[model samples]
Target: MKTDNSALARRLGLYFVMLWFSIGGIGHFVATGTFASIVPPYLSDPYALVYVSGAFELLGVIGLMILRTRRIAGIGLFLLTIAVTPANVQMWLHPELYPIMPQWVYLLRLFAQVGLLACIWWSTRPAPKAEGIRNGPQFP
Candidate 1:
């Protein structure tokens, strides 16, 4: 019997990413103030941006579960991660601002974001073409 471990891993990774974002999206609504606080002060209407990002996270989670929309979802999430980087950086720069969280946690989160991006890309990428398969019909 042949087993495709990579496929299985990718499926698991996709599920994990979906769940992570789903919870995060819901948290935006549940803890709106906390999320808003993290937003850089330079941005206008931080609360509105928090909610908007939350909605996008939820939408991306749904889109990720569907094969037809996975690519778009992945791209959206990748962009979202980028969009939120500034907030993470802000937090890192001012550890005293978030007294409850230590500096190391923020540093770890920065690294985790990179891993999350890699997972999104790996899980949502289109399947590779099989060997010898091309534009023409194939025979067994």
Candidate 2:
């Protein structure tokens, strides 16, 4: 009996993504100022961007829940993650500006971003249809 480990993994990943984004999305509204503070100096309307990104994060969570939309959601999330990199970079580069966060946190945030992307991609991937024949031709 072959184990459907991929399904299990996908489920777990989905849960993680859902919870992670749900909280982050809600944070945009909960502490809008805090989230906006990290925006790069060059960006205009930091508050709007923060709120928009938060909305997308919540949308991604919803997309991840439905099987039909999972792949596209993963792609959106991947791009969204990339889009937010600049803010993370800004934070890392301007540690003096964000004294509340420890130096290690900047590094960890960058690393965690990569992991989040991987999880979103892996979890949203559709399982191969020919499972029984995945190993080889089925022998009757």
Candidate 3:
């Protein structure tokens, strides 16, 4: 039996992302008002949207944990991030609305989402080919 470091690293990355989202989802319920406050003014029913996003986050975490569901989960979470971009934008445009954090933090969060998407894609992608002889080569 042999261990593949790349595969192990991907799995660890997946788990780390899952844990991060799980906590965020739970926070939606625990601090509904805080999450709702970030919703863009144009969106109606901020509280409901917050809870709905929380549900999807939990679902995405479950999907990421299962081997068969990882791809879908990655896709879903990626879309979810896109969907929530409006809120991020709102925060950036109206820093006065969310006084708890400085204006610059919201800008960084937009970039962070891109990194998170890349991590999710890398972690959920198909396993790499095993190290060995190639189709037309044989050594020793």
Candidate with best lDDT: 1
Q: Which is superior by lDDT, 1 or 3?
A: 1
Candidate 3 lDDT, tens digit per residue, 45-104?
A: 999999999999999999876767777887898889889999999998999988989999
lDDT of 1 by residue, 91-116 (tens): 88889999888999998889999999
Which residue ranges in model 1 land beyond 4 Å of their true spot?
Answer: 1-3, 130-140
RMSD score of candidate 1 (Å): 5.2
| Local error of candidate 1 at residue 41 (angstroms) | 0.6
Give the winner by TM-score: 2 or 3.
Answer: 3
The deviation in Å at residue 88 for candidate 1 is 0.7
Tens-digit lDDT track of model 2 for 11-115: 678788789889999998899999899999899999999999999999998887766677788789889989999999899888899999887899799999999
Clashing residue pairs in candidate 1 (N, C-alpha, C atoms within 3 angstroms)? none
Clashing pairs in 3: none
On TM-score, the stronger of 1 and 3 is 1
lDDT of 1 at 90: 84
